[model samples]
Target: CLTGAPGDAARNAAFLVDHSDCPAVSLAGDLSLAGLAWMFSRAAGVVSVNTGTMHLAALAGAPTVGLHGPTNPLRWGPWGRNVQSLLPHSGACAYLNLGFEYPDPPVTCLENLPVSDVLDALERMGLRERAFAGD
Candidate 1:
């Protein structure tokens, strides 16, 4: 299932489904907050950027992976036992604080984060059946 808010969520779902091996469905912009929470409770795992969706997923007891780039994980990351937060390796982009103050210029966006890191995080979180196969 591909679920999130509109805009990037819809585009992301489309892009993923276009390249996916199996079937995929998107609930972006189609679900209420309660609906989202219920859906999250049933999901095997959820990977979300720093958004309310991430917090909701964690609150709903889903294994969640929160991706952080220009935001500090310490301040805005998902909270729970079944959660993991992914950040850039250089640690240069996490500057946002109090939703206003930023001490450094943005060095990169989430695009710079490696997919391998995400996969590894899922594996560590036991969300995936197994580690990603070597290519």
Candidate 2:
């Protein structure tokens, strides 16, 4: 999550920790290239929005999966053998209105994405495995 220089970084980190069991890491607004390299070296797989971090992940040679919301995946999705992008249908524009005041709208665009869809994509990318055997 490339949180621009804003207070949203801590707030988003808190939300991620409270809502999901997945561990979350938050970087300060100005991150150095060395810091990013360190993170990439330790990451098993990178998942991120269609942001610069996604490009950095590709440069680091990590298997990356990027989520597309308001943008078209065809035009903006990362280009690399180790990267996969998941995008909603073209007609689905719910994410466009995010951060805007709305009354009783359905779940956000990303929330509407089914888990099976993400899992299938991950499986195809070889990010998920059925088992590991000892030598």
Candidate 3:
């Protein structure tokens, strides 16, 4: 399930939904922020880029995986017992004190972290089976 702010956010994620191999549903406009957090609280697990939702989900006490790139995990990673953070293997974008303070790099450093690594992290967290249940 892909839950986020509605309207333009949903429009922006059209390609993600289109390319999804597993069942993907958007509860974009259907829930308020608090409601969404509540939903996140009940999820089997959540995998989100380093963003507000990641923090929110972590605070809500959900099992969450935070994917990091330019952002420093030590400085900005979600804080929770069940939150596991994954940084790019390449240190090119690591430990950015203020991510936006620096000029943009030639390429997105997030691409340096492979999908297989994320799966491994999820597996370590015991989330892969539950999160992909029935997929």
List model 2 lDDT by residue over 49-91, tens digit each: 7778787776777778888776556777777668888876444
Model 1, C-alpha of 92: deviation from truth (Å): 3.1
* Top-TM-score structure, candidate number: 3
lDDT of 3 at 63: 86
Error of 2 at 46 (Å): 1.0
Shift of residue 56 alpha carbon in model 1, Å: 0.4
What TM-score would every model get versus the actual structure? 0.81, 0.64, 0.84
> Of the candidates numbered 2 and 3, which has the greater lDDT value?
3
Which scores higher on lDDT, 1 or 2?
A: 1
Give the per-residue lDDT digits (tens) of candidate 3, residues 45-70.
88899989999999998888999887
Which pairs clash in the backbone of model 3? none
